[model samples]
Target chain A: MGGDFGPQVVVPAAVEAAREGIAIALVGDEAVVNAELAGCDAEGLDIRVVHASQVVEMDDKPADALRRKKDSSIQVACRLVKDGEAHGVVSAGNSGATVACGMFVLGRIKGVQRPALAGILPTEKNPVVLIDVGANVDSKPQHLFQFGLMADVFARDVLGLDKPSVGILSIGEEEGKGNAAVREAFDLLKKSQLRFIGNVEGRDIFTGEVDIVVCDGFVGNVALKLSEGLATSLGRILKDELKSSWLSKLGTLLSMRAFKRFRKVTDYAEYGGAPLLGLKDIVLVAHGKSNQLAMVNCIRMAATSVRNRAHEHLVEKLADHQGLNGKSEKSAA
Target chain B: MGGDFGPQVVVPAAVEAAREGIAIALVGDEAVVNAELAGCDAEGLDIRVVHASQVVEMDDKPADALRRKKDSSIQVACRLVKDGEAHGVVSAGNSGATVACGMFVLGRIKGVQRPALAGILPTEKNPVVLIDVGANVDSKPQHLFQFGLMADVFARDVLGLDKPSVGILSIGEEEGKGNAAVREAFDLLKKSQLRFIGNVEGRDIFTGEVDIVVCDGFVGNVALKLSEGLATSLGRILKDELKSSWLSKLGTLLSMRAFKRFRKVTDYAEYGGAPLLGLKDIVLVAHGKSNQLAMVNCIRMAATSVRNRAHEHLVEKLADHQGLNGKSEKSAA
Candidate 1:
């Protein structure tokens, strides 16, 4: 689909996925896609290049792009999901555009008020799933509950956790501390049937106390970006420190094995991609500046999602829960 | 004055400040402070210990502490400011308690409705100030506007910027993006006298496009903590990466000088401490786990705040602006 480097990275990644027994429908400009794939061999694989004239720029307004450029790559990819032509859509492009396209074309799941972007963050213990990372800006208590449910389902199915505990991000771990929205969400979460672990502070995000952390897009996005910036800045700092003296360089050499293990744990690329939850079809959004290895890992992740039928499982669980809740309400009445 | 590892770190830091010709007033358990200073030389230095029995734990209710524990270190320190006994109060204690203590004891500056905790984050280009980090959770548009003004004053007086550019943290750079509070804040910021740089995304916080970034406490706290966690994790990861193989170790040795430069840039200790802005007195809050060096640096930062007369400058500017605005309103009527 549409991305920063668009067809160049997309074509090769698509070919690699196709070769690995995964059907890939590349949605972009036909000429551009073909030009990218001109030198590559996609033999004995189901690979199709869908025509999309318009390309959504990273700077373009999501609503404007969706409204004005209906035939954009993101829109076309979303249309494939709507028409049941593809099992999922993948993009490394404008996050807002992807979310807008998904909502507009695929539509939200029944009983799910707002869709959230779930980002997998590497923690000391395990990868923590953070939901609502810039998908919906203004979220209600009900929306937060739905987001928690959806994230729980995703973590259980994809992350292979038996019962993933969810925590609502707040200023304090206490029962009645936070803004109006967080307080309301906390109340709703406490009353829910899900495995809710109450409130978690900002410092607890990396401690891995809860598998799933639910927050509004504004808070989640800030957390996610701040983490990224800090990681980048720290990496730069550590590299500088190792070169300070000859003795430190020797110490670094002696502790090389330990450092490698640490690198493996902190590498964001190892997580592959973030899943756009509450969509009809699976959509994995890789980092825009992702290299070849990250792209390959993303394709592999996409294949896993499709094979597991993650979206269908989420839909079924959400439907069953809603049905049971409705029946309970009626009985109580 | 107040913190997790209270008298131990605070006393030594205060002694160091006194040695450096900065007046030191230790507002905590006098016995504990004297015991910690028994082995160290306190010659020809103005170091006085004020007794305060109450201590605020990390999990304690801030408002409750302010109401009940009137003689707590944080409260007493703030009272010193109210009574004109001290120019500034520094603490590494519970942030909530500090904020509450400041509000109740020191009171807000004229024309400032709410105070904010301004955390200085080290970025690639320069250090950026994040306002309202874990202070007032539920913030209104007017509160955010006041936070921007306070941050601007801080950058000018403390950070030494002539006209610091302020940015409202949003999902996108566009004016119409973000939630209700941010949207309202954006409008107010645009109309204000400060240098408003429009909306900035979460990713832009580290890019250093603006000197001061304004947000509600929830988002700001999450951003600050996430950045801290990410930096620590990334530093560990890079140390491991450099030891992966012999070639990598060699490369690390060759690039030792560059690596040290990088670490210096990302070192939080180098920044000293963060100021709690919008209060009548100068108050600096250091990290909870700050060592003796960090504490000493915090004292140095407090001296800087006192020397710059940050509190007096802020109060004068705010009162003058309020007076001018009031006159304009009367004339318009």
Candidate 2:
């Protein structure tokens, strides 16, 4: 309801998910959702409609909305997770609101210092998971270390990476390169048991140098958005340039097979959506302007996460790591 | 010479730059440079050879190189500019070494807080100038404001944008939605005479919302590199996808014109090279794997910067803005 094309794009996607034998609970204004689903056949689909009295505006502060708007759709969906009524929650609304609701309603897992938003980006080699992509903007080195640990567990349980190599994004590939936060994080990450691949440059993110790339929310958000913008602008430019001249047009014809492959590689929609990791329950946040196909994909991703028990796995791993560190200190003393 | 493709790609570029009537100074080992340029026609080309004793390894610490290797190629090239023997210096060598040598030799202009590396990104509307792309990792709010001032002047004098709108890169576009550093910088930039566009999100950087984008070196470097990686990966994927199937091949044939247009739009070669802004003399840094055409274009960009006196114009603008701010504060008091 908050996106530029929220209810419109989301309605058909929900219907499709029901037809495909996936259980879905549509949390929104009861009247509006029912109106949109009036003509669609929701047969044999475990479709439940939850009524919410309010909506969170995109411009509203997330913390304030969580505190004040008690009956909001996002808050209601999150509450279901808190009460074990729902396995996971999916939304295409305000990102901050969703994150805030998740943190407040579900609360952080024990031993998890901070929650980080993990975004799965489509790279040339498999998919790269970027954590802290706008969750904790002002994070300490310990928070970054925790983010790396949580992401490592999620990737192993969900993405099926045996031992994900972690990389700290920096200006250069050297150890002593970035700002104060990154430099300090590098020192900590290097000493950890995780497979730290030393420091990685921005260009290395897409090259698959590491499975998990960690940074503060501010830098991660910037890097993610910039990559999207460049892909978009480049796609538009390629379309324009291909039509400019006849020779280029013929060359493009000869190279058509290669071009389709290129399109799939750059397509973000195919990747489904980004998961807000460190949340107590599974919550997938799709792009606001997502079409029916993107929404369907997000649903599939959510189902996969729920089936894999990603959150439980993450919590267990974090606890074990913490326990090991504490035991080592006692022995040393 | 330390890049993936060394003399094979760089030698031809030097020859091409010389042929384009740009005074070329090849600053590497004399034997290697001469051997590479030996086969090419040297007629009517003002090409000179400057010999340097050392080459800064890419893996070497930037500060250590600056402090220890005083007679390196990067240092010698920058020295030529300091002594007025050359109008500009172009290198495809170590970026940190280049920045270090340039700062130590050419020196910063008066009242300039820090020198930033600004990359002109090809966006949706027009080219957007992103500054502080890896000069100062840890920066104060004052440094960011100066970066905005410098980027604005560069856009006006170099890129030919009239009253270029400047934006501070942050997680959110709202005024109060950033870290302590960004918040302080936002306040400072709002008070400056530059055309401040408040705060901009990561996605907006490529949307062409503002002509100039400013951030700390850590964030800027990550943004710039991530964009590069995405572009490269996208191009590779499109080529692979187009060749995947026969039907997609036909679609590629139909869309060949569009594909070429897309390539042209994403082509960094068209943009020539990124100017190392805030240096006393014009300095253009080419990518290590830059082709001959790219090197020639870099020379063209450097010549334009020199002809327009971009650095001098920027210094003047900074002084004027500082004076204006001082007077406004005095009047208020």
Which one wins on DockQ?
2
- DockQ-based CAPRI category assigned to the predicted complex of candidate 2: medium
Cα error, residue A296 of model 1, in Å, equals 4.0
Leading candidate by lDDT: 2
What's the TM-score of every candidate structure? 0.89, 0.89
Score each candidate by Cα lDDT. Answer: 0.78, 0.79
Interface RMSD of each: 4.6, 3.8
Residues B1-333, candidate 1: write the lDDT tens digits.
Answer: 455577777777778888889887888877877788785788778988778888777777888889888888888888887898878888888877887887778877777777888988777777899998878776877778778888888888778899899999887777988888889778777877889999887778887678999999888887777666666555556666676777667766766665667666656766766788887777788888776777888778777777888778777667645744344343323
The TM-score of the first chain in every model comes to 0.89, 0.90
Candidate 1: list runs displaced more than 4 Å.
A238-267, A320-333, B238-267, B319-333
Worst 10 residues of 2 chain B by lDDT: B324-333
Candidate 1, position B10, lDDT: 73
